[model samples]
Target: MRKVIVNNIVSLDGCYADATGNPLALNMDAAFDQANLDSISAADVVLLGRDSFDGFSSYWPFIADAPEPDDPDAPEARALSEVNRAISRRYNAIPKVVVSDRGGVPSDNAWAQTTTVVPRGAAASWVADAKRNGDGDIVIFGSRRMWNGLLGDGLIDELHLMVSPTVLGDGVRLFGVPADLDRIECRRYDGSPNVQLRYRVLAPRSDRAS
Candidate 1:
């Protein structure tokens, strides 16, 4: 069975969204970008929430081909453009499972491919089935709502959190449930501007019958 890994870029306050209701603001850092690309490269499939898929489908394809407007001639611009192209290419080629109430995704990009749109009620079961049927890692990026649901269900195997330096007073949080996640272990990285935290879910304890 494949492991479902949840990765996100969050603020100090746990807000995944910015004031403008856009989640990209939390992903502006270079470290976050690198981490996400690396994870995507290693994963067998990428899962997205409906809103996150909408945002990504709108931006990635176009941005992947377009160079940076401010510094088109800069080395950073070239590097970023290359990275975006590779990432976009992979996203287009990879199998994606989108969880949405609607049956189909509305996208005009040639690279846009929606494999299966499991109904809202069946998402949890479908995800579990996917995990049980596949190998390697299935990554979940974006979609805090979906993530929180999976977390609450205790379906997540590992968590890769990119903690940014900035703080948003009010916005979307990563974990909204009252469940205790204190059992998860975290490994912090050094020499990185953004803090990278990896957490593995621990097993629950149950009293045995004599």
Candidate 2:
């Protein structure tokens, strides 16, 4: 069976994206890029909402085609570029499922050859079925709404959250409901203001009380 892992990088205030709906507006550095690579490499399939689908499809392929590191940049910059390339390649290789109620995801479906689009109404059940039958990790990236629904359905297995140094006093918050989780691991990036947290979701609170 597969485990659903939700990986997100957010501001200290818990905002995944800024007011402009730009997740890149938050703090992300070399450590973050390496983490991204690691996350994608571990997952065989990715589940996304419409917003995340649009965002990833429009960008990841291009990054995959980007040039390798050159001598002109700093050592850290070159290392970051290498990591970004690896991240995009992994994203392109993995199968992805996008949950969108409406049409218009492009006939070509250019992000990856294995893109699957399902209606929003059926997302939870589909994920549950996949988890029951599939292998490896099912990863969710930048789909706050989608993951929250899965959380309500008691489908999310684990969460890998990176808290950056900056705080977005006001932005689109990631958590709309309370969740019960058991911390699995926590680590900090040396010389950087990034703290990564891993948590295993417990059974729903109501279930535990009964």
Question: In order, what is each prediction's RMSD in angstroms?
Answer: 4.8, 3.2
> What's the lDDT for candidate 2?
0.82
- Give per-residue CA lDDT, model 1, range 26-93, as digits (tens): 63555666677778889888888887787777766665666556967764564455566777777777
Q: What are the per-model numbers of colliding residue pairs?
A: 0, 0
> Which pairs of residues collide in candidate 2?
none
The positional error of residue 76 in candidate 2, measured at the CA in angstroms, is 12
Per lDDT, the best of the predicted structures is 2
Please estimate how well model 1 matches the true structure, expressed as its whole-model Cα lDDT.
0.72
* Candidate 1 stretches greater than 4 Å from native: 24-27, 67-70, 73-79, 107-114, 178-192, 203-210
Report residue 4 deviation for candidate 2 (angstroms).
Answer: 0.3
Candidate 2 residues lying further than 4 Å off, grouped into runs, are 68-80, 205-210
